[model samples]
Target: MRFILVNGMALRPRILCMLCCEPIGAHYLKEFSTGLSFCGHDCYALYCGRWISRAEQVKCPAVAETSC
Candidate 1:
C-alpha cells in the first residue's frame, strides 16, 4: 500500500468512502494538486463535482454566492 503526505501529515493512499466512510483500497484514489487519496469512484466524482461548482462560483460570482 502506498502512502502520501497531506498538510504535513502522512496519509495512506487508501481512504474511507465519503458516503460511508468505510475503509477501502487505494486503487480508487486519484492524483490531484492537493494530494492523493479518495475512497472510491463515486466519492471522487462527488468531490470533483463539488470542486468544479466551487471553482465556477469563484470564477463567476453571478452563478453562486460563495468564496473560494
Candidate 2:
C-alpha cells in the first residue's frame, strides 16, 4: 500500500502500480486474485506472467522459460 499527501492529508493513492511504482488515478489495470494494480495493460501482463504462478505465465503472450 502507498499514501500521498493531498490537501495536507495523507491518504492512500487511488492506484498503486506494482510494476513501475507509479500512482495511477484512472484507467489502471487490476489483478483480482491479489488485488494488485498496474499502471497499464503492459505492466499488468508482466506482473501476471512473471510475479505470480507458472499457470498464469503460460497465458501471457511473451512467455519465457523461467525457474522458480
Candidate 3:
C-alpha cells in the first residue's frame, strides 16, 4: 500500500501489481516476505522465472579464462 499526502491528510492509493502495473483486486497473489504483488499466477511465474535466471547468472558468472 502507498500513501499520498494531501491537505495534511494521508490517502492510501490503489495497490498495483509489480509485474503488470495493473490494479490488484481482493484476490491477488503476494509474497509475504517481500510484499511482491501479482495480478495472477502467470505474472508470478514469470517473475519467479526472471528472478531465478538472475540468481543463476550472479551465482555463476562467465569466466574470461577457463583452465582445463
Candidate 4:
C-alpha cells in the first residue's frame, strides 16, 4: 500500500486480483476486506465456492471439478 507523490498530489496504485492477477475495479472493491481482495464478482463467487462450509457446500454447486 504505497502512494506516489507528483505535483504535490498523492495517487493510489492499482491492485491485482488474488486469482487472475489483473487490475481490480470499483465494483470489485466492495469485496475488498481483511487483506483479501478479488478482481471481479465471478472471482469472488468462485473463491466462496471453494471455501464454502462443508455443511453448506451441498447448497453451492461446484464451480469446477478440479483446480487448475
Top candidate, metric lDDT = 3
TM-score list, all predictions: 0.48, 0.51, 0.64, 0.46
Would you give me the overall lDDT of model 4? 0.50
Cα displacement (Å) at residue 33, model 1: 3.1
Question: After superposition on all CA atoms, how large is the RMSD of candidate 3?
Answer: 11.4
TM-score of 2: 0.51
lDDT of model number 1:
0.54
**Where does candidate 3 clash, by residue pair?**
none
Q: What's model 2's lDDT at 67? A: 22
Model 4 regions more than 4 Å off? 1-11, 53-68
As for lDDT, the candidate ahead, 2 or 3, is 3
Q: How many residue pairs clash in each candidate?
A: 0, 0, 0, 0
Per-residue lDDT over 1-68 for candidate 3, one digit per residue giving the tens place of the 0 to 100 score: 22211232222466787899888765567665577767667777777777667766677544312111
The digit string of per-residue lDDT tens for model 4 on 3-66 reads 1112422224767777678776554533323456665567666665565554255554563332
Per-model CA lDDT versus the true structure? 0.54, 0.56, 0.59, 0.50
Ranking by lDDT: 3, 2, 1, 4
Off by over 4 Å in 2: 1-14, 52-68
